[model samples]
Target: MLTGALSSRMSSSVSSSDRIFPPSSFGSFESPGIRASSCFSGPNADMNEYDETDLFSISWNQDYGCFAAGTSHGFHIYNCEPFKEIFRRELKNGGFKFVEMLFRCNILALVGAAANSSYPPNKVLIWDDHQSRSIAEFTFRSEVHGVKLRRDGIVIVLKHKIYVYNFMDLKLLHQIETLANPRGLCCLSHHSNTFVLACPGLHKGQVRVEHFGLNVTKLINAHDSQIACFMLTMDGLLLATASVKGTLIRIFNTMDGSRLQEVRRGVNRAEINSIALSPNVQWLAASSDKGTVHIFSLKVRVSGLDSITHPNSPQGPALFHQNSSTSIDPLVSPNTGANPNSLLSFMRGILRKYFSSEWSFAQLHLPGNTQFIVAFGSLNSVMIVGMDGSFYKCSFDPVHGGEMVQQEYVRFLR
Candidate 1:
C-alpha cells in the first residue's frame, strides 16, 4: 500500500491593520491551511481598491509572474511577485465580466455581458499582453458563457457546443454538439491528437465523457443538485465533479465510469465554483462560495497477478474396467481448480479492502469566494480569482504539506 504525507501550514506574519484586507495575507504559509494577508505595494497600488461586488474571474501568468482579473467594469493585470498593477483596461461597454489567460501565451480571452443587457455578449475578445490590444475577436450567436484555451488553442464549453480553434490563428477547426445544455466542459488530450471531453449537464447534473468524434464511454449520475464545476486530469484518467449543494467532491475513473473515491468536506456548504488540477495530476484544488479553497491528493495503484495449475486432472494411474469383464468403475474427485488471474484478483481485492482508505480533505483560505482557478508556472502554481476581483497565487509542497501548499503571495490591483 502507498500512503501520502499530510501537513498543514498557516501564513507566517501579518499586521493587525492589514489583516482586515483579505487580499493582503495571501502568501504567508509554508504548508496547507495557511491564511495570509493580501497586500500590494507597487506602481499600481492605487488600483487595489475595488468594489466587493464587481469581481468575476482571475488568472495567473507563470512566465511573467503576473495575474489578470475581470470585473464588471473591465480587467486589471497585476504583477504577482511584486504585488502591483502593471496595466488596467476598462471595457467600452462595462461588461467585461469573465477573463481566462492562455497558459503558454500572453493572450487573454475576455467575456462578459453586452452593453445595456443583462446577458453576456455573443463575441469574445482575445488580447495580447505585449501590445495590450485586442488581437482577435470571436463572434458567437447564443452567448458565450464559458471559455477555456488549451495549449494548442482550442476553446471549449460554448453556449451549446464545443469549439476547437487554432491557438495562433483563432481559426475554427471542429465542433461537438451536446444533448443537454452544458454548464461546463473539460478536455484532456490522451495521445496528443486525440482527447476526451467531460461535459456537465445543466438540468440533470449528470456527467458524460466521450472521445472526440467517438461514442460516449462513461456516464454517471454525478450530483444531486446543479454541478457548479468539473475537472479532468491531463491524461484523461480521472474526473472530479463538484456541486452547488454541498462540499462533496466525487472522483471517477475515465475508462469504465467507476467511482474511485469520494471526498466530503466539513467546511461551509458553499458551491464549488472553480477547480484546478496540477500539471502532474497528483493534486486537485477547488474554490468554493465559503471563501475558502480545499486541496486533495490523488494516489493510484495497480494490482499484481498470480499463477496456479488445475487440480482436477487425473494425477495418478487409475484402475480401468478394460482389464476385466467384471464390473469395474472409475472414481473421480470434485474439481477445485481456479483461474490464476481470478485468484490473484480476489486477493488483490482483499488487500485493497484492508489497505485502501477514503481520501481526506484540507482547507486553505483563498481570501474570498473565488470564481476561477488556474494552475500555471512550470511548477504549476495555483492562481485563484476572487469574487471581489482580486487575484492570488498558491503553490503546493509534496513533503510536509497536503500534497500542495500555498508557497507565495500576490494580490491583483484594479
Candidate 2:
C-alpha cells in the first residue's frame, strides 16, 4: 500500500483509505453542499464593454449555461443563449489568466496570470458571487495553474504537484508530486465517492492514477509519447487517454490498469488539445490542433465493434493488470503483454506509423487548424471554443452516428 506523505498531521489510528483526508484546518468543518443557480456576477456596471487586450482564457460551464472569459479587466460572465454579458469584475492590482467558476453560481477560483502581479502568482482566491467578494483563499509555494472544486474536496494543481484539501475550509489533506505539468492536467469524479488523479510517472508515456477512496493506485503505460490528455467517466469506472502524438486514444478500467478499448484519430501526428467523455459513458469526444472534433461511440455492445464490447459477450470487465499494485515503477510490466521487445511490438509500431489510427464514428472539421476546448451539454450537444475566439454549439446523434450539426455560433472576437 504505497501512500503519499501528508503535509498535515496524521492520526495514529486512521486507516489508509481514510488517512488521505485529514481534519479541517479551521476549528469547524462542514461539507459544503452544491446549490445550482445561474447568475453573471461582477462589480462593473458596463456589460457591453471589456478590455480585450488581457483576454487569454475562456471556459464554458456546460451545466450552468454560462461561461467565464478572463481579461486584464478581471473576468466576465456571459449567458450562452442570448450571448449577453451578465457580470463584470476587474482586478485592482493584477489580471487573471485563468478563472474557474463553481457551476453556475458566483463561487469562483481566481489565479494570477503573470509572475509579478497585485496578488501572488501561486495563490487561489475562492470567491462568492452573490456577495461579490472572496470568502477564502489557498496559497501555494509555486504558481497555480489549475483548480478543481468538488463537494467533498478541492484539488489544486501546481506545475509539478497536486494538493488535495478538504473543501469547506481548505485544509491540506494530501500532496502528490507530478512531472512537468504546466497546463495542470487532472480530473475529479463528482458522481461517485471516488476521486481520480492523473499525473506523469517517472517515465514518459506512463501515467499514475489514484482512486482515492478505494485506496487503489495503478500505473498505466498508456502511450508512446508524453500523455497529452485524459478523462474519466462520471462513475469513475473507465478512463480515456491520449498521447502527445495525437494518434491513438484508449479507454481503461480505473479499478485496475486494464486497457479496454483504443481509438485512433488520424495517422499524421498532431497536438491533441482535449478529450472528453459524455454524461452517459456511451460517447467519447476529442479535439486537436487540426481544428476538428470527433465523437466516437463507446457502446461495446454494438454488432461490429468488438467481441468484448458486444452485448452478449461473456468476457467480464477487464481484469486488473498483474501490476495493479500501488507503485509507479517504470519497469513493471502490466499483464496485457509479456515481452516489451517482442516481434509483435515491432510490427504494431510499424503498422501504427503507416496506417495511423481509426477514424471516429462521427467528426467535424472546423474552418482552420483551430485549437479548442470541448464540453458536453444536454441532449447530445457539445460546445467548442476555438483559440481565435470562436464558439460553436454543435449537436450529434449517438445511436445513429452522423456529422455534427452546428446549432448556434458566436464569435467573441474576430
Scored by lDDT, model 1 comes in at 0.52
Model 2 regions lying over 4 Å from their true place: 1-50, 60-65, 79-84, 300-357, 399-402
Clashes of 1: 18
Worst 10-residue lDDT window, candidate 2: 1-10
**Tens-digit per-residue lDDT, 205-301, candidate 2:** 8888887876788888888788888886654667789988998888876666877666778878888898877665567889999888999766322
Q: Which tens-of-lDDT digit does each residue in 1-414 have in candidate 1? A: 111111111122222320111212112413233233211112322232344426665655433356667665566666555456666654323536567766545577766655513224555556565544444555555566666665565564565676666655445666656534545455554334436667754346677776553444567678777666787755455678877675678777666676756565544477676676665545667776666666665543221111113335545422212121111112222111321223444466567432232343445665543455544444645666565545566665544555446665544433
Deviation in Å, model 1, residue 80 alpha carbon:
4.4
